[model samples]
Target: MSNNTVVLRLARSDDLAQLSKIEQTCFSNDRLSKRSLKHWLSAKHALFLVATSSDAIVGYGLVWCLKGTRLARLYSLAVLPAYRGQGIAQVLLSELEQLTQSKGRAYLRLEVSALNHAAISLYKSLGYQVFGAYSDYYGDGSEALRMQKRVARYDGKGIRLQVPWYKQTTEFTCGPAALLMAMYSLDTKVALKQVDELAIWREATTIFMTSGHGGCHPVGLALSAIKRGFTAQVFLTQLSALFLDGVRSEEKKQVMCTVHDEFITQAHKLGCVLYEKPLELDQLYKLLKAGGRVLMLISTYRLDGKKAPHWVCVTAIDEHCVYVHDPDLDASQQAIDCQHVPIGLMEFSKMATFGKNRLRAAIAIEKLP
Candidate 1:
């Protein structure tokens, strides 16, 4: 079959079986079942396009339009083996890109297995750039490369900052990873590696936050940044010791208290500024516009439905959404990965609180100007 003979159009309900077959034939793991294909076909803001040759399905591409943001996710793209090298995949991709662009989206992002050189080459040829990587993302232990391409144009009026993003190697190190993003944004000379990540975690961790070796407190993170020669300011909604609510044992409570007190003393000695108020979205916008980076504490429940306190860097802010560089990567769900993730302002506010204390913590770090 020639490329000119293939016809590309929106997938219909009748094409679900063929789409499922193509998915199974192209991918060994993470293949969408027939039921899943049906769901995607019926989902709101979903675009599933199929390429047909001789009135038979040869390839298909699926993309999702993110709510309240001008972004689209290319969920899957696959072409049958018999139809390889005829530009069928490229045609499907071009059609999908046009479809997404017509919908007013500015970017189209996707993930491909690192081993899929052909697919990666095709995406690169079509102007996609690899922005990040996920370790052991597939069910078969294969890593995935995250790539994106801009499908629409913008004037770039809002504060859109770009920072080096790193995912935490361990679940307890989100604080360190987020802080590293902030520090790196201010000082591009700073290297981001696992050694420095763990080292910073050791210096800042409060030994327990709800569970498991604790998380970093705002004061400790501020002190760590200041010690590294960056100006740091801590913002908190409450003046009390942090991470004290989840510790049931008196020994653990006392240990947390000791760590918190030590951080407070270090902050005072190091001249780190502390503000006794929650960092509002407007305040964060102003700070980013003024060329400062912020590390914020938020609940993971909003991103991946996990009820744990996490940290992310505020990289950009505009009228529609707040962009962040999340340190933890949820491979199963591409939306939560550490990249230019856009969260609605209202959703961000709900995700910024944690525990009964409704702890809202943020730290702004910047170079001394």
Candidate 2:
């Protein structure tokens, strides 16, 4: 349950059957044909990676490495339902970046549906910036946001350590670093020298981060990162999300609180910093000055009253600027001006209700180290 236990190497031709199944299960009506999967399996510059749990494929990703340069394109990524909150897709992504970077790739690119907020948020949190949107990019005429990330050069020699996926477990049990010991004992049959390939559905009652749910659920990922000596935290807010897809109104507070508490506790136990409510602009600036990466959870309310509560990551900040994931924006650019962004704090807090009282407060910050 902890550690970068899953080994990500190259996908073999035999993996076509499983990969095809995943594509079908993940893409709904947009599933690719077996023939297409075969093409990707044999792709020369493309790398396919499968996330396995005791040999069963749980997730996958595909990346296209440019032939003559260090640029790579992330074509597709997915993780099965039961395996999602575990951060399997992220591991596959970070692995692809490592694979491409090893090949001298400097830039990473991908296109996501304009409505797919989860993908947009994850990529931005991982250091990707948006460029622009391609109208009607999908066959169904849906728009797509293009995103890209620049990989830092590798200076460490020896074998590079594989990164682990962050998981959210309700028990708030074992940390990821300790969980890694278990992962290291697993068998790795993957063949590394071969090419790589890439390939989530929302299930109900399972707690979606995008939906505002108040409860104390541990973010397994922060614990995993802490175990590895990396400062990791989960970000959440008390405000209602304006655009969540599948959560109920009464459940929002519980979902958000649980997710927030879990990440904070795990981060603290792992020796990372934890920040709770009443966070001010000065406190944020001070944290950044301490010389570490911080994940800020900002809340957005849907003034239109049709969407659910949501949150985004604050990746960068300055006196006059704040850079965030802003899943609502197109993915091909770096940051957006705070003034033009969606759902400000004041607009979000007004949605919360305590018994007969409807509060207009728009913001609350809980920091996890």
Candidate 3:
């Protein structure tokens, strides 16, 4: 090998000093501290690599791969000023993409400073597309552009519903957005609008869950679907007051109980099917096969490391994966990231629970034939 040949290797504790120096020289702000660098050097969730030329650390790339998810993130990639003209950045990025695929991840996501035109050009040249942006995202108050690239091809023979992606307009309206998606998938005549979303939220909210506006209760969601002229069934593990654990104030708890009770009563009066049982994967697959659309409550911890109850539309399923249309789209996520998200069968189950009680709830909807 030539003396200047750039060699890439896993970052190690021994290279901490040189890596720190390089980081400080490359980035004026938002530089990782030595402690963080040391932590990531050994963090299993992070893949840290260093590029060396003439046995000197010249550049580095980082990949944050969360366990049990088909996603990886390019945390950072920086090359020394002297090595700017060389293809070292491209080489490091390509290797990172390959490693992402090796870890069974389909997408490699990243956030880059919006002002960095050269870096943005490099990413675009390497097949990355800008999907979304975050305002005031950096230490210097610079905006960040979110980009993602498909690193691995999904080989599943997918069985998916023709559902259009509709992002929730608010932070707490995922349930309504999901319900609308399911309804639209079953009947294309259904309109997706914020007015209807808020309307459903008013009917389906649990009054007060946590400190926010409120979360959608399963019973309320099922009842909301039924009221819309769609045949609906709720598969739930518990028949008691839902989302109560997320509330603390006694007055809020009482209001939630009253709302849930009314919803349960309405479901009974309307002859809604309430299957009080765990939603088995096979059973869910059969429902999908029968052309039933699903609105499932899931914990967002696996998807974004935020432990909160979130609703998503189950648009499709296959032998190896279950695809969902997530209604909650943060600035970091585009419609591509939220639409037809392929979660592995096992990973889907793990993400389908919420709270310490591990509450599992799903609403199935079908068109009246």
Candidate 4:
């Protein structure tokens, strides 16, 4: 194919011999063998991409899609020496990622020999970072640096959408500001005026602490805030039909059970931790009783029929109070002290509904480095 028309496509069984030839030529002793090729080409989650020039395979990359964990591993990538500067390798990688996203993989992880500057540079330019290292990882005893790219939003077409708020603000939706102070965390000059877009609410990250649901909206907003120079973790929670599916008298419990289990299972695979026990004010108060650091997610909804979504984060807990950053409340809004927040074990048990076992809450924590 012409350089302008270099087609990157999935490697097929018929192309195995050609791929093996390229591998052998590129990695003499370390090349993947025929047996390995058989396994990789046949595996369902295995991603195999080839860069073709005039219909001849010139480069290839392999990745593994681990859906339950939202992780994709780049096992090996190689390009022929003659095609080194033609950008065939880049084409292969882009197509491989497109394939990865198609399979619902979230993070793209890979190990590269520490000194392999070329490969490292390629990954870095593609937004990968060194997350860890594997000591003496290679058979030859060379250490491998583990690099990762949060791939939750990658599509062959690039980011799904450049959030309007993100374009207006220079920050991401998740960060010290989104977590610690909410929109008040942002500089006033850059914060967008409160507006409604397609039923989605918009406010300064600080405004999130103002109400329980404020925090829920900020999760996506937080992502927008820090879109530049950083990759933020995205945690989506929607209390749509799923949350209130069984509240109506005529609803079927069996359908709700099946849906709930599937949803929880998918969430856990996406790095979310499910809290089976309902969250009561006192239970949360107990967790914050010692003035210790606690990361908590709180939500409230109507038990009878109407279900409105609300969520908040517990930043600190002390003997007398639980300190929270409520985005719904403005920054000047007083810190909600647990004692006066109108939470009693009895009332909390009712409002939270965790005791009734009708609704579920979960949190996904992504530690920043």
TM-score (all chains, Cα) for each model: 0.73, 0.41, 0.71, 0.45
Instruction: List model 2 lDDT by residue over 180-268, tens digit each.
Output: 21222121232111121000001112244343332112233334434434444333233233123334555764664565455455456
- Candidate 1 global lDDT: 0.84
Ranking by lDDT: 3, 1, 4, 2
User: Could you tell which candidate, 1 or 2, scores higher by TM-score?
Assistant: 1
Residue by residue across 62-166, what tens digits does model 3's lDDT show?
998755567678888999998888888998999888888898877788888999999999999999999678799889999999898878865556567788889
In candidate 4, what are the lDDT values of residues 1-369, reduced to their tens digit? 235757777789999889889878987445688888878898877888788878898888899764222347787899889889877777777777767767755456778888789889998998889856767767778888877775556232211111111111112222233233223222233333323211123332222232232222323333333332122233223332233332443334344444445544444454333333544444544433422222233343421233443344444332323333333432322122110121223333344333233453423232233
- Model 4, which residues run further than 4 Å from truth? 1-5, 154-369
lDDT of 1 by residue, 94-169 (tens): 8888889888676789999999898899999999999778899999899999898977654344788878878888
Candidate 3: misplaced stretches above 4 Å?
1-4, 10-52, 55-68, 73-94, 101-104, 109-154, 304-306
lDDT of each: 0.84, 0.48, 0.85, 0.49
Instruction: List, in order, the clash count of every candidate structure.
Output: 2, 53, 0, 37
Q: What's model 2's lDDT at 318?
A: 40
RMSD per candidate (Å) reads 5.5, 20.1, 5.4, 19.2
Q: After superposition, how far is residue 150 of candidate 3 from its true place, in Å?
A: 6.6
